[model samples]
Target chain A: MTNYHGQWLKLSPVAIIYFAVQFVKDVGNNLIYLLPAILVGYNQFSENGLVIISGLSALLLFVAISALLKFYFYQYRLTDGRVQIHSGVFQKNHIDLPFERIQNVRFEQPIFYRPTNHICMLLDTAGSSKLEAKIIALPKGVAESLKQEILSHKTEQVSNAENEQPEAEHEQILNSRSVQDLIIHGLASNRIWIVLGALAPFFNSLSEKFIAGIENLGVDVDALMASSQYAFWQYVLFFLSIAFIVIAFMALISVLGSVITFYDFKLTRSNDRYIRRNGFFTRHEVVMKLSRLQMIVYQQNWLDRVLQRVNLKFEQLGASLDRQSAGTSGGKIMVPSVTQGEANDLAADAWPENKLSAINYHPVSKRLAVRNTLIAFWLLIPLSGVLAYFGNGELAVASITLFILSTAFIILSWKRWGYAIDDNFIYLRKGLIGVNYRCFPIHKVQQTKLSQSWFMRRFKLCSVKLVLACGGQTLPFIKRTTGEKYIDTCLYQVEALRKSWM
Target chain B: MLADKFSNQSIKPDSLAKVSAQQFTPLSRAYVKVNLMCRLVFWLIVVSVLLVLYWQPWFPLPKMVALYLPQLQLAAGLFGLLSSTYGVIADKNKGYAIRQHDFSYRSGVIFKSVVSQPILRIQHVELKHGPVDRHFGLANLEIYSAGGSMHTFAIPGLPEEKARELRSYVLTHSDIAEND
Candidate 1:
């Protein structure tokens, strides 16, 4: 009677390394806040070399000892249809998780446990907004058996009408990213902007250090920059070359990051679940049940559009549902750099009746554009005039130019806003330079919100927000009649269908 | 048996009950007093905190407040009065209703909003009450769906017994819908 059956059990000794890695990861993620403390400690400890060395050793020893204690205290027992976990050295935690309550079960294999073939199993429950449980450093065979047991229990309890869907017992390859695809994804996605934004705080000191480094390398950087002999064209060429090098550097980093994170990325379908296997350093296997998937968001940035590739995000339940948090990194599976045909194929598989290729999209009311124009011109013109009156001619000119540019962009975005609802699914599309397509089953809608601002009410228009379990999507400035009609149909579907939207 | 009923049947959106047509049941009138009282208490605490910070030897706040004490007090008092008064007016527009297969809450004064959730989608419900709310015999019914961390909508100013009844009814209906 091992842990797999009726007896209590302990995690493998290798779990200490697992806990140690977790400690390092937490510290690294919080490095910004910890920087000041680290600097102060370093200043205080720098008086004596021996003290600093001993201080560092003491921290490491503490981490190691804590990890050991955590590993030793962790115990789990897998009984009939449930798993009871007893853990924690100080504040004890007891979790009795039933198989039916578990929404998802994913696995991770860190580099530390790779040699030993131990797995880290993460369980997510619908009741919790985050990962509810983690069973670290379990033998691969035991983990697999546990997963199967859970799956068996889950399948018996789902009660979804879609349970009769192609529950492929064998693994069927759905999608995979090639090395070229990964590279294209890196080049197309504006992940570099995010990295630069994070590093923006250090720019001033970084530039200073760079100049000093250049000086130390025997280059007369100041003199070269101060010289007036260089032609405008030559200076332009110098700046252009520097910009080119920087862009190339950013692209390199993006490509390396994409490769590392998406190495050997392969998505497979097995037993009504979409299994995603990826990661270079730490192999990750994420299993998303088909029935639990709320929606699929299809995105195309400028480069992605140019390359005729679309990135698809399969969204599930997440905590940040109310606010528009674009990149919260919750329950989602990202499939980047896929062809339109491939995207449609994936969409068709997820929701078979999805008309991704030939959706008859209806544009929003024209009053949206008129309203925006009125607001923009009435307010911006006066503001620009005030700036000019204050003798800031350049600022005024830029503001007017910006007004025109922004107006054009807004017009494009408004024109692209289209929505279509069929019997089963509803699709919403909006974009300025890049397109975003969101689609979900009509019945999967958790809630419907109709909002009318004072301006919108005057125009007989309303904003409709469809709140799904994954994330909410808002269709702004649509005719009130149309919005009501959509909501009515949506509600009718929800009432009539009674589909399990777990 | 459930699979047999699944179909791509055409639905007349016009025939279905329009969201705009549904009549909303307004909250208890006593809620306005409760709302005003809660805001008054909050503003009082804020004012007290500001006074403490300005008078106490915190080193930083005292000098700043000393220079603009009258202006700061006026601004806070004005904002508090305006906010509390607006809350009372807004509470008049707040209401909730349980329909055939869902629940709806209508709220806001200038910016009107109507939120509806399917009975089956509701994961849980709760009835909440503050001291002022209890004094007024008013309760807030919070309805949660299997979505975000936030409740779908929290309909406030319901009579206490009504709020409890709504919660229990919603929970029962949701369970039945789930098992249907």
Candidate 2:
């Protein structure tokens, strides 16, 4: 590994392809706006062949020129204790971050960079999490050396620095995901349904058009449905098969996503820092610092519970969890479909006191269940009353069943609310059917708030909210006195430790 | 489980120095006047704009809509006045305390909250004043910690000089922020 000696250098010319891919990915991510624009522009484009061709070419040329310009302007230099970046063609921006502030130096190898053996380096700062995300198209070996240089430089700063490089640099393979594990992870996650729900309106109109088209073909679909005299058992079997197919389809989509995104998922530890390497098309290698970690989230969905697997997320002290790395290249360290014991060990590595599997959690007050069920009771009246007024007994039964299920969910949610505290870490467990476990150090709490509504005040209940850098966690329906006690304890730890989490 | 070991400690909640909102100092009454004045000016402008829109001949409304324009304007005005009245009442309940170790602000008339940020977490302080606020010698002091924007809360209606003093105090006292 050779030093740059402060010489400013441009990236490999292959970076142009990386930029083009990035441009397409960015556009693909904004499909909501793009879809409508395409719809509105479709009529105009359909009117003329030449106009459509020219418009598409204009878009392509714009992307190409911009990508080329971006690559041309982007320059970087590695010097002692600092990394300088020169980028932004129009804006003419320059950024220099000290080694200590560069929280992570990750090596990313997108699909296009595969042939050339080049990697895109992502430098993450605590506050400006993604603005200075890329220093693209370095040779793979060069990127590795650069990462080591930054990490080692960071170690030489303060003696008690949280990111101090460990003595033995021997790398240890902490965990690896199998194909079966990946499939289980896919089966457990419900993101596909969420996407389907988002696209429901689009699908609704498309479905109506499709049905009209079929009617135009003289298929007599409604008559065909009326003519069929299927037996009750046959109908039940048909519905069960349909349910199985839908579930299988969902699993297929999720499994495909998991395969492409986390094909060879591995979590390895070296010199007190953790590195996650995975993805098929784009070989992603994310380095996570020992210091900046704020929370570990253990997730188990209903399917995951049956399969005895959990999704573990090692969160850092910056971006909120909603914008977490799933489809996007965010700094989310997720190891999905691991055994509970494995998840427990991974969590304990960061926070030694986080014995999540065996922690004795105190359940939230039962009044939560009572209050929620009572609140839900109001919906039952409307659910039945409106349909019953319309003289629909079947609809009434369905609504009644729905109400019962919702009540059960509310009770289960109340039962799931639990929290445990050790000397250093505060572990919170919550869910309905499936469970989620989150734990963070006491000192990581930036602020603690106690809030109460009028009804809660009357019931002597309140919610305690702990604000960490990554996100806020709320403990709802705790006793007012207990909420205050939590606030006191959290503030005491925060002030006493006075440690910088980021 | 370790829950059994803490059974003895459960007899009494650790009598930590109880920091309560009851100890908070009520905001200066001038905040009510300042807020009311701002609201009054706001509603006045809103009414004026509605009147202009109603009487303006360039873009005329349909007969049915025009017939009810005065009523709509009156409703909006009444609503704004009512909200201002509520705001005045809410201002009375707003209190703040700058303690030795932390800063606590108690707010919200209906959904009450007591938020405390440790001094060690204070990242930055901002004191802002608009034209109306300047005229009334008031400033809004916002303190932010090293977290999401939700971790920060704004304290509105501080006297200009007091706001400056508080800003200086926080800047000098936040040793952790300074180190960062």
Candidate 3:
């Protein structure tokens, strides 16, 4: 073996944008805050030359500070057996990671780091239980070689005596969904809201300008307002038209955005890991291992349930990316969309023998649903009456329409809420728009609670919630008497189980 | 079979040496002190709001006082007497035991919770001593599990020496690496 020492660098297009955006944001924020001071100091400037010198000095200082920070706190080294990082100027923190414990590794070069050939290496390890994410600006080939070395088989394992098991048969080298699947997923999604978002500004501007132009004309404003206020047909036509146009525009934008973002969405399986590569302009690569998965969630909304499709998300092993990663969908490895049977089959493939049971759960009956619908109707009646009065009965149609819609909503809400239990798993299927079939292993359930609210108690209904090590799942609005009995039995069984988990 | 035993053997070393039954000596007059503080704070807020709202020179003090007198007394009584009992009961119901092989805790009054952890799986053992607990010659033992966010479990009111011994015993007995 030779000691290969070289300066390595590579970056993605995303890195370039990220760096430029961050730099611009930092400068803009400071400049905005310092505007008053800068203006006040303007009078003290003797000449243009002095001002220019001062600006140049300040710019040089800023660049020097940034570069110094980068130089001092950005150390990375890849040895034969492990990766080493000694960073931070003040405290000098060090991280030593062995190759054997490394579960999954990924190379990302955001557009900002692209020009410098700097790549970010996110390493997931079995121990330390940390993501072990770091940025290593290395040559493309060297970065790839380091990843390969960590992933490569070793002769040392052969002599270890305990490493005699043959390689996994189902350890896939590469697997991905077709472009057709992505297209279907995007089309089926409820993304019509984006077009509305795009059109909102235009509509707002138009309305403001129209109102201003009318005011400028100086006609009898009060009489015109009174005429329109009493005109029932005009009011109905005007509001409805606006609503229809906005919804249509939103639908168009949402459809276009989805198509471009997930154009070639793909997920590949390699050895002990799964890699998800998606997004056209800003490509994102997420790598995760099988063992790190605490649980696999298959969910569907009402739309998905009716369409017989489910979404898969994996609960990974660690501190869960903190709050900042919430915008990135909580860092969960989502397998986008699949049919109900396909979702089950995929879970089975991931965890071979485990499958969900079909022990039908009794949901909150039609009686409760009707009661809820009546409550909603009564609550909205007063508001609707007030609106109807204000608009001279033009709004009466709106209230009647809402009352009619509530009937459908009440039935849908009740129908979507259900759960199933098996010897090894608990499955909760709920939601109206994007249905979710959440399954958790019985052994993984940390605790269970059966709660009754005043409204639910009156209707003889209760909610049962199960807490797990990774996350929580709830089966809401179950018949109180039956729900209590079911919870008691489950608790007893859980207590009796020989193995202990908490 | 040999490999299982080998791994298991490496995990549990001198298990009996670390096993102990601890009888926690409950906090004494600290309960009364806390109760008094709570009552004082509660009354302060109530009186301040009343004074601010009804600060009129024309109105007689007795009349204004009589209006809020019953509610104020009820709040004060509830704070003074009921809170200490709640705290005592909460403390009494929580107990845990640790051995070289494993640790188990029994908690909660209605919905009981019991957590048990094997020594080999523990990522690290922390001995924390706060000012209040230090004055009472008490230390809390925390055990962190691997790859889980809610991994840390704390058992309070252990003697400092015992906490140190437990930490050392676990370190020596468990084969798991302390990476974090």
Candidate 4:
């Protein structure tokens, strides 16, 4: 008797590649164990070569049987309230997952999967590591129907009287972004990473030119530079030209990578979940619950600030789940880059009542500026002494220029740091090059901590950090008395809101 | 995650009073040795720094010591003060309340924060025991609250049986109630 009473299971086009990959991996893994035995047998009985032949035959038989079993036996079914999977040959194996136990379900259709009309579904649960169950190369329509069935089952399970209108089941499939939006956002973020990428080539070219110049010092070309002191400047010009060329090459690579990564990026809304789809080759699909969002952070780099574009990140519950080796995978989920206006619109969509404004605030007074100058002065003290000892006026000037520029940047950043709180939410903004504004409901905060250092305590200054499920929000520096009062008010409101909020 | 708020008579002062003071795992004598060694090492560094600054006659020791003396003294005094205050706060906040709908633990000195979370809101509960805590017959109960930034409401020094009872009660009443 079969558990999942369904027709003969059809393998997804994705299954072909997945099965092939797995087969190769299994063969490779077993080879490590089998290779030594075959080699040893071959050496031991060169005369009686039957041993090696038989051993090879046995290994091939083992690989073939296992691969065939794995590919042929696995079966899945989408029932009314649960997903049933069955596999195994000698001893049958069966597993059923009820919809209620599932935390989230999302589907990804890479370029390859898109052509085949096959989608991979990832089921997340309340476990340390994700991937409780996966149905690879599932039929797209069947997958959607399965998702709807699960959602309907989930809606039926919510016992709350207030939300018992069967309203949760009526999810909206959000509108996708236009190509214009994607191109604009892509261009806005392109320049900075371009400059960063180009820095390596720029430095490499300069170093190479320096080495070349030293190499030419003993050759016929040495006379050109020796006779004409102007040749030193010419050497510098040649190095600068090479640096420019390298910078251009890096800039081109950065632009191309940015375009590919964010090409045709689209964010769609589906009632409780925000669906984000992006990537060129290995397309990614992320589904995030609106209620589960811990905090929404709007960030703008120096270039982005100038461009009036803000990148949005929705920090949600759960640890870093993406197995891909990317740094920005966890902590926050990006909404496929947006302009400041679009970002505000997204925020409004997520939280209709908490409409963010364009108001800005100032941080600390000239003390921040004084601190910046002090850092510069400290660096200059050592630098000027070294320069004076070495009698290098050029080095001294360069050091002074660097010191002044850095100090100015820090002072500007400090001055720009501030926060705004309104209604039942708080917006904390900070940073220089990477400015971010993180907003969340005050009621969501689980813990409000106010810390004071000895210096801060003396000066009546403190730092307030509000801990949320996703992460913590910190007001790094604020007046101690104000900080304490602010924390107390927020805490009282949080408790009161907790009692009344439902 | 805004939890489902419910009112029930399960939460009461009587529930706490029924819990015995004898249930607490008494602080072991090993703490005295560890605490003393830490204090001794700390003071040794302080005394050495002070001596190097003020007592050394070969260099401009007095000036440097004078500059740093207040900061060092303040740091030492504050450490002693905060630790003592923490102990008092811990004592005051020691105890657990099991309400019909939720459980909470309140602690800390300067920041008196209480993690009042509903049993329904708890995604999971973890029971951990350190070697010292185990030796003292104590267990640490960490309750992970969902819908908020993953803040684990932890209570240290709960009797092993009480921890188990609370864990069982929370587990039985949580979202998984239908699973069984």
Best of the candidates, lDDT: 1
Q: Write the per-residue lDDT of candidate 4 for residues A206-295, one digit (tens) a residue.
A: 566666777767655556567765757788997799889976675556556666666666677766777777767656676676777767
Model 1 residue A121 CA deviation (Å) reads 1.3
| Candidate 3 lDDT tens digits, A18-125 | 443545567887786676566556657545777789887987677556545645455566565776776655767778777777666766655555556655666765
- Evaluated against the true structure, the overall lDDT of model 2 is 0.82
Off by over 4 Å in 4: A1-10, A19-80, A84-96, A159-184, A190-241, A319-333, A359-406, A499-502, B1-125, B137-180
lDDT for residue B11 in candidate 2, whole number 0-100: 26
User: Which is the leading candidate under DockQ?
Assistant: 1
Candidates sorted on lDDT, descending: 1, 2, 4, 3
TM-score computed on alpha carbons, candidate 3: 0.65
Docking quality (DockQ) for each candidate: 0.63, 0.44, 0.10, 0.10
lDDT of 2 by residue, A1-502 (tens): 5557689999999999888878977888887667856765777878898977998899899899999999999998877778788998899888888877777777778888899899988887765444555788899888878887788776666535555544857778999998888887887887799878877868866667678888999987687556667666776897799789988898899889988888999999986689999999889888887777888999988988999998999887666543344223357688988998898898878777667778898888888888788777787858788889999989988888988999999989998999878777888999999999998888889888889888788889998999988888989888887888888878766665566676
Query: Can you tell me which runs of candidate 2 are displaced by over 4 Å?
Result: A1-3, A30-32, A36-65, A160-166, A212-219, A228-243, A321-329, A378-405, B1-13, B44-78
Q: Each candidate: RMSD to true structure? A: 3.9, 4.6, 9.0, 11.1
* Residue A227 local lDDT, model 3: 79
Error of 3 at A6 (Å): 9.5
Encode model 1's per-residue lDDT on A1-502: one tens digit a residue. Answer: 2436877889999999889878877778788777646654775667788977897899899889999999989998888888888889998988889888887788888878889999998877766443277888789998898888788676655445446443547999999999999999999998999979877877886788789889999998978888898877898999999999999999999999989889999989986789989988899898898887888889999899999999998987773643224322435788988999999999889888988677988899888888787788877888899999999999899889888987898799999899998768899999899999989899888899999988889989999999987768888888989899888888888877777787
The i-RMS of candidate 4 is 9.3
Fnat value of model 1 = 0.85
Candidate 4, which CAPRI tier?
A: incorrect
In terms of lDDT, the poorest run of 10 residues in model 2 chain A is A320-329
